[model samples]
Target: MAHPERDTDSAAGTGGDPGSWPARQAPGARDLAGLDARICRCRACPRLVEWREEAARTKRRAFADWDYWARPVPGFGPPDAAMAIVGLAPAAHGANRTGRMFTGDRSGDFLYAALYAVGLASQPTATHRGDGLELRGVRITAPVHCAPPANRPTPGERDTCRPWLARELTLLRPTLRSVVVLGAFGWQAVLPALAAAGWRVPRPRPVFAHGARTTLRAADGGAPLGLFGCYHVSQQNTFTGRLTPDMLAEVLRGAAEAAGLPVAHAD
Candidate 1:
């Protein structure tokens, strides 16, 4: 189903300039909705722009009948979320097709099921943008918004996309008190963004591990933020038993509690 919230048609256009739109517009966004709109309209990275459009044009056979979102997948969840879940990037046949982060893919299946088990999600499935799935006290976003070729975004692309994540962190700073990063890539990518968003990262950056935890002090003497690391929900981890349902649920429950949200005990 085509997401009514996305402008897939006009998404291909550069909106007056290709490589300079994000830095020029991201900071000026006063609200999450405005930031999301600007994010979806960005065409700052030529390589990512071409790859996402190609995937949309010659889509997977299973979704040939479906219209791919083909644009930058915006962060999903309420603006006042107390916790944020950071991931690597959008999956090509997943969010790149369904227009919602972590939707239409097995990775999403694992992540959402864990969230539901921990009492943080409204549903255990997320197949599309309109699937009635909602996250409580948490938001999901990525370092790179567009789907990259071969599931690996170059270092240049990652740096170019930093402004969007930095701006998102700024918007969520009011209520965000905890973060769960789902891989080393997202961990490294998010630390700098967190510092840029007004949190003072420790001098020696914390290392990434399945159960690593760190505390960041707010630069302006506001509330402290807890950062947790977990294995990515990619098939490589879940299928190999490197990350299990029980394990994921435990981490999410811990993070939710750290954010001051009431978490139900998993059965």
Candidate 2:
């Protein structure tokens, strides 16, 4: 019933009539700005921000002191998405500089490729948020919104950022069905969120393994939201062959199937 990719609002009233009324354009800047405003000046962890700005300044020599968002990176996707992809955090030169998750850095290259392969991403390159790339049913976000030094976020920082994720997920409401966590940290963050939603932790304690899957009922007792885990796809994993393209694709295939959607392969 959810034609996520189509502008369904356009055809809803006319019953295949082309001239009844134009479909409502998807939510735009005002919608995203409201979400961005919440974290614009987040000073939740002073130490983290200090380190982040220092990293930004250090890299400014090459970046030419580029105006960086420096603020917390907000999630990008349809407001009524069913699946959310959680990453570790923004990269220093990537989202940290570009102000968009997974953009302007090498780290995003493979990730975007994978998204494109799966029919989620429309553009092959995620140069910036303005590149006009749009996700269908999938939303991409992070646990720690800001990029941390060496890509390691302190426990305190992750804890502080949890509320934002919780609030956004709560807003998505009935449409959210599953969350795909990129690494151990993201998996850990989701646990407290699930608890906050009143779902008890799994009896055996869900392990954060590649290809892992679990389901927790929403607070409303409707359908349970599925959770899937995948390798972080960091430099180490890819260089050491711990995670191969085929392996990542297979895990995503499993996740997509669990979401009851068709899997698309790259030609």
Candidate 3:
């Protein structure tokens, strides 16, 4: 749906350095925890909330009455990670139900496999947040914290939810060495944040091609954070060969090296 080349000026509201955007950073780290609490019980958009609840209540047409998770999915990974993987949002019955980012979906299947293959994740199973799976130095989060109708959240909703994402990055600052953006939307959501923080955006922007890497200077400290862009391994991509396990693994390998972690070659 989102391609990197699509001019972002319309979506971002400004084509220049994002530092000019009017939004302010979250009040403090305490704001982060408070935002988390709100996310857990958010009913900001009544229509979407009702739709999500309805989806969970209804059985899959073919499956009749199968269980579904239809709630706010939270970010997951090692608390002290140097890298954070940013995704778009939760799949209807996937992370929304499981309460963890990128779980219980085809996208997640490919991603977790790559994460495990590269040793960033200790376990392949991401069925639940507490599945004993751990990311060595990586955390996974989404731009839209709440699941949206038909897997798409509106621009207003995304903007409303932007503060949560900002808070996450802010609280995880100093420790974050790099970020792996899983799709164009992920890149878009983060670029402005980086700009607002006074970071240098990569020339040509961060392209969405798999395994592409861009080095950026942090706004706060001028530290370099290697930004890696990748095509999302969504069902559309993986099943159609638009994304492959090996390809994704290569990106992970590069990201690991960028994060100063030991890299392992794919078998």
Compare the candidates by lDDT and give the number of the best one.
Answer: 1
Off by over 4 Å in 1: 1-17
Stretches of model 3 off by over 4 angstroms after superposition: 1-28, 31-35, 59-69, 202-204
Worst 10 residues of 1 by lDDT: 1-10
What TM-scores do the predictions have? 0.94, 0.82, 0.82
Ranking by TM-score: 1, 2, 3
Worst 10 residues of 2 by lDDT: 20-29
By TM-score, the better pick of 1 and 3 is: 1
Each prediction's RMSD to truth: 3.2, 11.3, 8.7
| lDDT tens digits, residue span 1-267, model 2 | 122244334332234432221112212112434545545445556666776687677776668757776666778788877778888988877888888788887668777777778876787678876789887777788878878888999887787677666666666656777778888988998788666644556767699999888888766566678888898978888788887777777776666666665669756
Number of clashing residue pairs, candidate 3: 3
Residue by residue across 1-267, what tens digits does model 3's lDDT show?
122223323333244433222132233335334445435544455555677677677746743454565666656766567888998888777776666788876788789888988888887767766688888889898877667787777877677667667767776776777888888877888886666545688677766667778788876665688889889878878899988888888887887888888766865
lDDT of 1 by residue, 25-143 (tens): 77877778878987887888899988999999999999999899999999999999999999999988999999999999999999999998888999999999878998999999999
